[model samples]
Target: MTIERIRVLGLGKVGELVAHLLGGAGFEVAGGDLRPRPDLGFPVDVFDVGDPESLRSELDGFDAVVSCLPYDRNLGVAEAAAVAGLHYFDLTEDVPTTTRIRELAVGSDVVMAPQCGLAPGLVGIVGSSLADGLTDLRRMQLRVGALPQHPSGVLGYAFTWSPEGVINEYINDCEVIRDGHRQLVPAMADIETVVISGDRLEAFATSGGLGTLCETYDGRIRHLDYKTLRYPGHCDAIRFLLDELALRDRRELAGEILVNAKPPVDDDVVYLYAAVEGQGPDGLTRREYVRAWQPIEIAGRMWRAISWTTAASACGVVELVARGAVPGKGFLRQEDVSFDDLLSTPTGSLFRDEVAVA
Candidate 1:
């Protein structure tokens, strides 16, 4: 279907920017949230997103709907989109939620794409692109971080993204491929140091970051893993909270406490690194792609690095689906998206303008 009128649910930081980018791309974008949002450059409605019937009613006459609500609320929105016969998209990293969406898309005609955020989204695309050029692929490592530019705390982090999502990834079991077999490992285990652009950061296994890559590359790649990058001592501090303090059992309180501690920051940086190792025509070799992205001006305003990057990646896929550059039917995997095609889109090309790290 040709996408024109698009409805965006949830008008938080990332959702607002997603609507902005989609509107800039020439799509008729309307947004919905719990409270009324004024002067968003598009029409917005205040309604109950939790009710599937209300959401389905709101989705009528729209060619597509983008859910930027919390991961838990996306399934209801996806079901509403299915009922409305409209294309569905979301930026969720919740495994169970994506699994249900996949089940919903089994025989559906509209496209259902989830986990269109940074690690699971763009990193998967980059890793797959690297693997496509190798003869004997041995391993693929993907890492990403969103941190304060000038950190001054024990955790050395700022809540650039959702606090609940961050806590979920930290406490859940991570999926990986080890020794050519799929396996489940504990989150925050197997910590390692990663050096990118002269910055020393620690990386550890995180759940939902791999998306469907473990299933896609199982037995094909010898070992495949994805990790979240943080400054030194961050993992230890988090372990103290989740393990030693026994806060893992009470995730809601834990999220509230952590968010109270390290709130969102305006000046932040996002670091991404992807490496592939395999046998080429000559011999064993490695290929890598690394970048440090900072906040920049977009549509006459400066946005957080994490905010724009996430919005750009999410909207880029939407633009591609609208143009038929990406598949318009059934489930859409982020790994299946072409990196070159993503970069060619108006919003996806934002990744090309990286900050020069010293």
Candidate 2:
């Protein structure tokens, strides 16, 4: 049977990008958002995710649904998609939300895939692909960041994407496999510095980057961790506010302060670097480096690095589903797609040659 069409839920930056990318690739793409979006430049139906009956009606006639809504709202959309028998995909990093989606996928006829952005998305795919070939893995580190190309503020960052996600990354408890034990480490801890592509960058513990790798590689890898990369002094300042000022307890007020204070930007850069060292049959070997950065332009628009990576990564997975490259049922992880498969995909191929390592 010919696939009918692909519907993207949420017309935010990421959702809009997904719609355009998929539409341009020949899929009949439609979009839904809670609020009317005049800036979308295309007609997008307004659909309330909170109203299940309305959401189900809106999702009808589509072969798949890609949610770009907040992490908390994703499960509702996923449920609506399942009831409609449409494939489901999202860019959420919240572990609990993802667990609920997985449960919703049980005995379903459609697929449910989440964490399709930079860290939980391509980083998991690339990092796990490297680990798959290793024997006796010792230490694995994954670092990803999206920052403005030019900074004029003291924070040295821009609100290119979700501010709530940024706050969650800073304040949420992080998962780390240290000394052969899985444990929770407070976010923004374990600060460290590294150089990528001749530029100095700082990295620290962040939530949700590991995805399910901790469970997948548990008791096998000695030390495995994921960190968010940032410019110098970025982590220190954030830590000062979230920790020293005790803003973690007041995320809403902190988010307001950040949104009103720090401006967003269009010209931005995304940094992705992973290192895996282990002993193999031949001896000791380490695969460590960064991907070559390729600026992205979509729908005659140029987005900052964060927008490019996050949106493209998600659209790539949607393309995979449309082509039957992924399972049609059950929960899906980002690591399920190999680097080769991702590079071969029409949407994901854009990053195949763009990765550079130090």
Candidate 3:
């Protein structure tokens, strides 16, 4: 799979960055959005996501399609890309969407990989890597947060990422492996606190972040869970909207309210924490991987911490699959990618060695 040309879907925050990074990385990259995109100094085109012919023309002659479209829209793009004889990758965190993609991957010659962003992306790769070394795997915990370095507002949060994604996690039931059995847990429950970089943050169960890890490690691990970290009091405020206001039943309104109210911030941070403990050759031991990323300037422009991380994760894999490092066919999982190999990718190396809390 020598990828000489690539097509990126969506020109939103993360999609724009993905196109920029891929272009700078020396790939022949073109970007498409439902509407015309501004001249970002790269090749961008406009197409309707709902029109099959539009997607076909937008994605024509590209070796791969990196979907930054909303989760609900990815299936169509993926089917189009498969028809175009191109590999399909996405940043979606929706479980049902991934399941649909998995079904589409069957008997297809190209790769169909979704949930390639952070949390469901790198976090799974790291957690599985650590769990692989345990002599007797017991419990694994993953926590990630994209937060404002300086927090304010009544919600104590700003949209450094997708507001709809935040709402989806709040209302959906999370899947976790408990007592060696797959279990469904309510979202935004199981409040806990973790101190990273000396900043105390709250964490709770979140849907879709776990991806396929539970099924991949099912019947083997005792306890496994993934949670989202936020500043103290953040979860309670979200709970009020979901429970007290009954906004869970009114997702469209809740999404709009949060999107209109919680403004996006450029000054943001991404916190990562993964820990696994169990019996080892020597004894029971624990190893943790932690990171805190700040916004940085790239290609003569600044990218939010979330934007860069999320895009880089997907773009990095594009390189790996092009080089034949990953399986070219069948549905893929983040755990299917090797941690060391992923870290060796240009984008994966960005978070490999850096300043993270000890």
Candidate 4:
């Protein structure tokens, strides 16, 4: 069989990384973005994401469309992909948008996979894979953080990804399964401290990180939650701003504040830690733990850990779908991915070796 051809939408840092990884894997790669991006290292076909007809025209003749754009724009892209009968994938962590995409996927001829990035993407896969091995699953906790390698700020965090997306996760409603019941909890409300790899970190409920897992494991598990990890004191500061200052009601203002205050950097680290505890076949309790510490590198260019992991994971799933590894129709969740299949893919192998060492 011939290699699949893909067209990646959005030419941001993550989009560029997707194009490079797919191109290296012997796929004919093309890119499309709203604005002209000359630094993408290859020709970027200009197409406005806001224009649905134009997007449909650009996406023609491609096996799949990988969207690295923000969450708000993903619905349109998914619609375009479905209409064109091309597989659709994105790195969104927004709840409502993902819900819409799921609705769009019903009875469609092409696959629609959203939330294919770090927390909602690989973390969900790893956690669910662990859950699959247990005889009687009890609890599952997933924590992921993309932190600056070197910190010098009040928040001790950098804008490694989308500032708006970060704000959405911080302030939006989170879906969690508590006491074997699916519940919606406010983000930044259930703050807790955790120690990983000898470094103290903070974690709290974050929106869109669970990616349909609460419903997937609703009655089977006593607890299932996903949190975003940050350095010590980061949650408190955000809580004060979002809760005390009433910034949660004003998400646009909150996003602007984060954009203006936090600095974007190329030197960052992505941390993933997931733990699942349940009963074993021997009538003994067992636990499965997966941890990954991936640092940033971009061949010769500068790319942060968040950028590399988030972008690569999305592109990796797209590659898998194009190569006929994933089902071609209906709604797809991150947890549906197989661990072995993921490790064999070119871009997905980046996390595979890292997790092996951890």
Which one is best on lDDT? 1
RMSD of 3: 1.4
Of candidates 4 and 3, the better by lDDT: 3
The number of the candidate with the highest TM-score is 1
- Candidate 1, 11-45: lDDT as tens digits: 88799999999999999999999998887789998
Tens digits of per-residue lDDT for model 3, 79-113: 88777878899998889889988988899888899
A best-first ranking of the candidates according to their lDDT comes to 1, 3, 4, 2
Model-by-model lDDT, in order? Answer: 0.90, 0.81, 0.86, 0.82
Per residue, candidate 2 scores C-alpha lDDT tens digits across 1-358 of 1345888887876778888777877788888987887776456888688998888888888888888887778888887887788888889888888888888889877788888988788898889888777889998889898877776566788777778878877888999899999999988888898787787878899899888889888999899999998888888888788878999888877877887787677777888888798886678888875764545766577766676677778888777766778775788888787777777776777786575665
TM-score of 2: 0.94
| CA error at residue 41 for candidate 2, angstroms | 6.5
Which portions of model 2 show Cα errors greater than 4 Å? 1-3, 38-42, 292-294, 353-357
lDDT of 4 at 259: 71
Instruction: Give the TM-score ranking, best first.
Output: 1, 3, 4, 2
Which residues of candidate 1, in runs, are more than 4 Å off? 355-358
Candidate 4 lDDT over 106-136, as tens digits, reads: 9987788998998799899888887775756
Q: What is the C-alpha RMSD of each candidate to the true structure, in Å?
A: 1.2, 2.0, 1.4, 2.0
